[model samples]
Target: MSARMQVRLWLWQRISAALLAPLVLIHLGTIIYAVHAGLSAAAILGRLHGNLWFGGFYALFVLACAVHAPIGVAKMAEEWLGWRGARVTSLAAVFALLLLAGGLRAVYGVVLS
Candidate 1:
């Protein structure tokens, strides 16, 4: 990647990390609160049952995961697999799509279905 592209990606990664920090903390705290409140799976599902707020939050989380993981994997591939250039980026793109598909599937299950 060009230096400018690398810088943009670096900036994106940092922004995502900044956004994710509170989200993850809130997610964990929500889980803890739910369990402490004695919410059963059915009860929790009822709360998320067709709710847009939870759905949007989860979708955002999945999107971030999709963006974040491949960058990490791309760096790993560069270091460990000695892969770079077009091949590495292509692989990372594939990895990102895989994450998207799987994550969105889960998100759909929780949100719409």
Candidate 2:
């Protein structure tokens, strides 16, 4: 990757990490609350259905994760696996897309179904 592109990726990864911290906390808190309340999966889904706020929050969380994870994976591939060049970047991009697709699909199911 070009120097400028690498810099941009670094910046994006940091920004995504900042976004994810609070998001993860909130997600975990919600799970704890649900479990403590003895809420079943169906009950939780019923409450979440058609809730745009919940949907939007989770979508952002998914997006942040997609952005954050690939950079780390790419870096790991470079450092640990001795990989580099466009192929590593392409694989990272593919992983990001998969994360985005799967995460959004799950969010859609919970929010719309």
Predicted model with the maximum TM-score = 2
Query: lDDT of all predictions, in order shown?
Result: 0.88, 0.97
lDDT (Cα, tens digit) per residue for candidate 2, span 1-113: 79999999999999999999999999999999999999999999999999999999999999999999999999999999889898789879999999999999999999987
Task: Name the lDDT value of residue 28 in candidate 1.
Answer: 100
Give the best candidate by lDDT: 2
Candidate 1 structure quality by residue, lDDT tens digits, 1-113: 79998888788778778877888998999999999999999999889979999888988888888888788888899899899799999988999999999988988998799
Cα error, residue 113 of model 1, in Å, equals: 1.2
lDDT measured at residue 51 in model 1 versus the true structure, 0 to 100: 92
Over the full model, what C-alpha lDDT does candidate 1 score relative to the true structure? 0.88
